[model samples]
Target: MKNQLEITLQNRKNLHAILEQTPNEDLLKIPQGFRNNIWWNIAHVVVTQQILVYKLSGLQMRVPEALVDKFKKGTVPDGTATDAEMKMVADFLLSTITWTKEDYEAGLFKNFNEYTTSAKVTLRNVQDAADFNLFHEGIHLGSIFAIRKML
Candidate 1:
């Protein structure tokens, strides 16, 4: 789980780099044939990790309820992200992972509500969610990369 968190942290650093470097307009652009934008993908991953690992573990999410509502599964980009909101997402990309690692090390997660993901994978514990989150982030990273090409 420590290794998984390390990889998640490194991946978030890469995501943060992209977020910092991309023009805000580019981040919000939804390319043809895509339902969402780069910014949405980045934010979605952050929201997802919280839900999968924390919310389902019966703990409150690190991020706000509004953020979770906006980016959680089945929600499309709302077509707007204020500068403050963007920065919040960018900041959480690292901070949330750091928190997750710390919380895990502290043994805060003792039980996880079983969840069957859209991909049909069942997460029975925090460890499963931790592992599944990596795959979820990889998928979004690929989407971000492809969107960058189109931009």
Candidate 2:
């Protein structure tokens, strides 16, 4: 689990670098054939980790409810994000993962409500959610890479 946490933290750092380097306009642009922008994908990953690892574990999410509402599954990008909002998301990209590691180390996640993802994968525990989160983040990372190419 520690190894998984380390990989998640590193993945977030890489994602945060992309968010930091991208111009605000570019981050908000939704390319043709895509439903969301680079910023949305990045923020979605952050929102999702909280949902998968915290919410599903019968704990409150680390991020605000509004943020979770905005970026959670099935939500669109709304085509707007202020500079401060982007910075907040960027900050959470690392901080959330750090907190998750600490929380997991402390055994805060002793229960998880079983969930079957839209991808048809079932997560029966926090460990499962943590592992699944890696795959989820990878998909969005690929999306970011493809979107970067289009931009």
- Which of the numbered candidates is closest to the native, going by highest TM-score? 1
Could you report the Cα RMSD, in angstroms, for every candidate shown?
0.6, 0.7
- Model 2: CA > 4 A from native: none
Per model, state how many residue pairs clash: 0, 0
* Candidate 1: regions farther than 4 A off: none
Q: Could you give candidate 2's per-residue lDDT for residues 17-122 as a string of tens digits?
A: 9999899899999999999999999999999999999999999888999999999999999999988888899899999988998898898999999999999999
Residue 88, model 2, lDDT: 92
Residue 65 C-alpha lDDT in model 2: 96
**Candidate 1, 8-80: lDDT as tens digits:** 9999999999999999999999999999999999999999999999999999899999999999999999789
Candidate 2: C-alpha lDDT: 0.94
TM-score of each: 0.99, 0.98
Candidate 2 residue pairs in backbone clash: none
